[model samples]
Target: MHTDARVLNNQSLIEGDICIIGAGAAGISIALDWMNTSKKVILLEGGGFEYDDKVQDLYKGKTTGQKYFPLKASRLHYFGGTTGHWAGMCSPFDEVDFRKREWVPGSGWPISKKDLDPYYAKANETLKLGPYNYEFDYWRKELKDLNPFPLDDKVIRNKMWQYSQAHFGDLYKEAIVEAKNIHLYTYANVVDILAGEGVQHISSVIVKNHEGKTHTVKAKHFILACGAIQNARMLLASNSQAPRGLGNDHDLVGRYFMEHLEIASSELWLFRPFPTNLYSWEYGVTRASAELAITEEIQEKERILNGTASLLPLSVGKHQKPRMETWQDEDPRKSSESLFKNWSEADEAAKSEKGAIERAFQLNTRIEQAPNPNSRVTLMAEKDELGVPRVNLHWELTALDKRSVRRIHQLIGQQFGIAGLGRVKLMDFLRDEDDDTFPDSTNGGWHHMGTTRMSDDPGKGVVNADCRVHGISNLFVAGSACYTTSAAPNPTLTLVALSLRLSDHIKRII
Candidate 1:
């Protein structure tokens, strides 16, 4: 059953077996798994069915350390959460992403990719995606024309990505509303978490809405399924009991903030026309596209971080500019429309100049940043309408991140030179070795991760392998906030897989 928290009386108490805060992809996915089960689940969403200006204002905060999108505009606060505007690109984390790399500080996950393989397959169904096969060879067999770049496997190999069009809210709303065991409460913004004696167990959560109604949700187990930034924000803001916030005894609640550095870094001038069908975007159907990724052998030899480079024809890439206006808007639907319009214009222009186009193409980089302790999200003194402190983001990038991008392009250019296939012109910022500062064109994927990072050691991470918050048995964290490393692909697929894994653990425990 679905209800609005605003309509409930003040100081009312709602009880459930399991309470999930934030009805995003993670929260909704978990709740769906519990449908028709014996468990009584309560899912809390901060906003209504659609976007609201007042609720969005709660996300407004300050940003420093790096030029970032306005805090208010980074994520949506509706029933579907950020998935409302997601493009649905899905790929699993590489095996190397889970291993411990000597060059990457604070790297490695307590659980390996193998641990989540079964769950990833299950997640594909929930995401409304095609087969879970990400192998280039598998896609080549399915699509006859899907040929990979003729590069040495030891030096560079092709990586695949699948697409999905499922918007959780629109696609699963009916099922969720009709589920007898699951209760979804909209406009139920979580303001605080009340802890029991000894600060070991969570007694209940304080929720409020703009209508001036307040209530307490009491559950045996509490899971924070909010996004990375907000997950840490709520933990930091709930300072009534633990002082440093619940499960934040080690001061590791919001540190090690990571983002995939998505930037157009160079231009590749090829000798011949590359097959557009293999690399260009495809809709509705699941297809594989090749991105030049360095092999693990080379990463070990050079001691560089993981990264991938994608090619785009110069004709289409030159017209592409940073959509700041779209990103700064509170409503994500506007951003999605703007993105589609921009892509359509570029596609039309590319087709008109098909024959007259040059051999040149743009090289885009999607590189992972090494986990740094200094990069974090802290609470600001200013409070929002709910009297909760707003967040101040300190997004810091390291020299290694820049070095990795430059090195990947350099290696790609060298291979092209040897094959007599193309020549690459490095971007101005990358040309100078001394200038480590990234250009204004450099932007993040807006994929927040690694805030409440997982580690077996309590001193190192906020949560353990099972996503249970250290020192707090009844409280757990969900979503990318528990990611130990941000891999090259988008985090949605892996995050949903992780959520499914967490759900199983909760079921086993409860």
Candidate 2:
């Protein structure tokens, strides 16, 4: 039931019970749930099964405010989406990430962690993960000689991470093609969403492909499972009915963007060799990494955002160079190969000097940036091959983001001093309390989130608790775009879980 949209007749109307756009992790997960069901599901992908430079160039645009990766290189526009090159790091959002914090602006989700608990377990199966466990003690019992740093729980605790090798395009392609009730259309890019009377319901979606073919997809329900940036861009671009864009009356469609502040902030010089395999990266099996995180109690006292710092061997970290500078190729595969080569060389160099290395490591910070409305994705004047406006990203970081990183390391340094673990040398940028500017080395996890944030109040968010667009009945938005707050962990797990939850809601209604 899978076909290339270019092969279909131009201006043909393809009707279905449900239409899910962007066959990425979220879109594929949702489509799988409806397999063999009576509902006729149509899934759309912008690109073919593999990478195409022409399609990737559609993602290129201007980046203002904070320096960022080239928009074209930041994301992959293939069937699997960005998961094609994902590092497989996965973790659920903490409970505190859902609750409102006075310090973080536009923080809090309408639903709590408990609400997504069942779906997270279901998402684990979809992700081909080991188990639904993230506890440090659980991993400690499973892993031999696995021990944590001697630190107070009130001050610092271990944050667990799990890895998944499932590439959605490769793993689920056969199943998707074989599904009787599901029809997947590759190279079908949704250029506009045609709205019905009063812009309350979707009539159909205008789709185009590079082959110069255009068609229409009509469905009872529509779910935008495209990644954060494209989801916002599409909503902002479909301005035929609502004028300001469909369901964009509040001017909140592409606002409140958030990303995890990933930076190598400091060095941890331990007094003795820390022989533990728990934190090291492992594949094909479940493992947990220890990250020094400040407790929720301390966060309330200090009024700072949530953050975690993981340790890496100094020998390995010192050799690790920035890839953005040299990775100028437009094709993601070439860039990925270059990055892998660099990491391989660095790993070899680190191993060669391993015997002479002292008890020292590097501290890397992964922190949540407070939601700022100014940080957004707006439509650029330049149009892509499909004649749709490209996205212009204005990624903004707050002073609180800088302060939190400095404070977290300072607190960790103090605890290390008290426990006699060793001494911590703060990075030059963090040493200056008055310096609010981030260094060029300061980068994000490349995790895009929070543009179409969910909220109970229509005035605040593009979608509601059910992920349905505000004032729109049959339209829903899936993926990290609906995330209210981007947690320190990667957004894949939580976003897939939320997609499953949305699927359940759709089933209940239909």
Candidate 3:
């Protein structure tokens, strides 16, 4: 059954077996996993079905260090969450992302990729994606006439990406509302997480709405599946009972924030027309496509982070603007409109060379930033109308992050030249070997990750391998926020898979 918390009586006492906070991809995925189960699942969404500027304002905050999207417009607060407008790119994290790399500080996950293989298959169904296979060979067999570049496998490889069209709100709204076990509360925003004795277990949560109504939700277990920034804000803001906030005794609740740096890195000028559909993709029509990437062997040799380079027509790419600049509107709707308009215009400009890929291609680099503890989300002094602390994002990049991007392209360029594909012209910002600073136009992937990172050691991370809070017994986190290291592909697929794994663990206990 679905209920609007705003309509519930003030100080209402809602009860459930499990309370899953935030109705985004992660939260909704976990809730869906419990549809026919015996346990009563309480799913809380801060906003209703549609976007409201009032609720959006609750996400408003400041950004420092690196340039970023407006916090208010960066994510959607409605029932669907940010998936309402997410680009459907989906790929699993590389195995190296789980291993500890000595060169990258704060790297490695407590859980290995092998632990998530089964969960990833289940998540593929939830996301409405094709086979769980991410290998280019698998896709090449399934599709027709898709020949790959003859690059040495030891150095560079083609990374495959599958698209997911499943928007949670639209795809699962009916099932969620009709489910007898699910108690979805829209307009219910969690403001505080109360703890039991010793601050070792979650007692209940305090939720408030814009209508001045406050309610208490009591559950045996509490899972925070909100976005990374919001998840960190809630943990940092609920510090009344626990002076340093629950699960943050080690002063590591909101640190090591990371994002995929998506920037125009270089131009791959191929020799003559290399007629192949390997690197091109039409968003809605294509099921899967491949991008240039470095192998783990090469990454280990060069000590660089994993990243992928997608091809764009030179005409459209050179004319395109950085997403940071185009997505500046404080309202997500306006910001989305501006962004799509720019993409549509670029598509129109690139139509001139549709039949002929004959010459130059722009390589847009999407790489993970080294986990910098200094880059983090902290509690803002100003509170929202709901009396919850807003988020302050300090997005900082490391020297390793910069060098990794340059090195990735340089490796790809070398491989291309060796194969006599063509020479690669590095962009101005990448040419300077001594300069560590990025241009003002450098764009971020809008993928928020790693605030409440996972680890086995309490001193190093907030959550354990099972995603439970280090010290808190019944409190857990399910989302990209638990990521110990961000990988090359987008976080949506891996986060959903991780949520499923957490759901299975919760099932065993309950």
Candidate 4:
């Protein structure tokens, strides 16, 4: 039956077959999966329908890594969550993403890529993507000869994969409001999870609002769908009763946070068939000549060969050379003076018809990072609105992550040369502290993961093979936080798939 959560204070506490915290992408996906079911489901959210100062205040913090004004940052803590501003880039994790690599210590997932293939297809459908194929050329032809910008100085090509255009609040509004057995509450912040006798049985969760009022929810099954950071925050904050936090028996609640390190830059080049707005409206990359700089095949081979990374195709802009900049080291292979001279000559070249053919695609690469236990999040002395401790994020990158960056650059340089994409140039003097885009410099990450990792053994993980919290028979996780490995792709698709899988398991239980 439909119920307004605000009635909890005057009336009785709400009880449900399943209770989910946070109404973001994963939470909404789970709610939608059981929309018309007989089992009662309640979805709790911390913020209202739109972005607000109070909601944004929760995300305020001192920057230790990537420094940017909080106002300009795209992340949000509202009803719809961060998906409101998400660029909708959607691509499934490759087979290698689920495997354990020797170079990537503490990597490898309990499940393999094959296990999620079917769910990946379902994720594509939910994201409105046409299909789940990476064959760029065949799809290019299928698009009626829509081509990528042609360039001669660089080997420029386009890569196509699924992209997402989802806004969970808007996408699932009808289902949520109309569902016979579902109740969605706004401005309901989950402050704590109250576990039963053994910390293995999660009996209820405490939620609060701006008015200093509190509400409690009891459920047979509970799922934490809050984003990676907040998910850990809630668990750690609920420590009044549990000494080490609800699922901190192994101290693996918030470790191995990761984000796809993106490098964007721009420069002029001598290439033909230039179009400034290449693939701006396409679902994926559009240029025809571009080859897969990195692929599942490459990643698998790398894993087998003990290599640590895979390459994806890089795209250059068509005209006005997209004005972008990042740091890099001066090529050691060529003296600085020699390269400077060549750059000066190229810079002096006129903008002619042939130069119009010269295209520049803004290229970005997602190099794999090896997991290090040192990079972690722990509880801080500071407390939030509910007199609970805050989370202290301690993120670090291993030397292997740096090595993978260098290796991927080398691989891209070689492939661009071999495929005649262009005169490939590595980033220059980036490690120099003086440079804005130096190696030691930090960047912001939207992909938060590995906080509550999944594993076959409960000793090494918080979630079991099926995503249920190891000791807690009724608690589960369905987001990037459960990932064991950070693949070189967006985490949304995989998250959606896992949420669906979790729904199946929850359905069977409730």
Model 4: CA > 4 A from native = 1-12, 63-74, 146-159, 265-291, 295-357, 429-442
Model 3 residue 150 CA deviation (Å) reads 1.3
Q: How many backbone clashes can be found in candidate 3?
A: 0
Off by over 4 Å in 1: 323-326, 330-358
Candidate 4 C-alpha RMSD relative to the actual structure: 8.1
Each model's number of backbone clashes?
0, 0, 0, 28
Model 4: per-residue Cα lDDT over 1-510, one tens digit each: 334454456324778889988888888888888877788898888777776666556654432443322311324676667787675776667666778776567778989878887877777777767776656566665556445534332322344455567787788777787888888877777888988886778888887766666888898999999888777777767776678887778888887766665443222232443343324444344322232334445444544211212221232222222111121212211222343454344445433334343454434445444565666667777666655565566656655555445444555556645656554444553333234332433333357777888888877887877888887788888788888877766678889888888888877767
For all predicted structures, in order, the TM-scores are 0.97, 0.98, 0.98, 0.81
What lDDT does model 2 reach? 0.88
**Worst window of 10 by summed lDDT in candidate 4:** 322-331
Order of candidate numbers by lDDT, starting with the best: 3, 2, 1, 4
Query: How many backbone clashes are present in model 1?
Result: 0
Candidate 2 Cα misplacement greater than 4 A, ranges: 283-286, 326-328
- Order of all candidates by TM-score, from best down to worst? 3, 2, 1, 4
Best model per lDDT:
3
Could you tell me the lDDT of residue 431 within candidate 3? Answer: 89
Q: Show model 3 residue runs off by greater than 4 Å.
A: 352-358
Q: How far is candidate 3 from the true structure (C-alpha RMSD, Å)?
A: 1.2
- The model with the greater TM-score, 2 or 4, is 2
lDDT of 3: 0.91
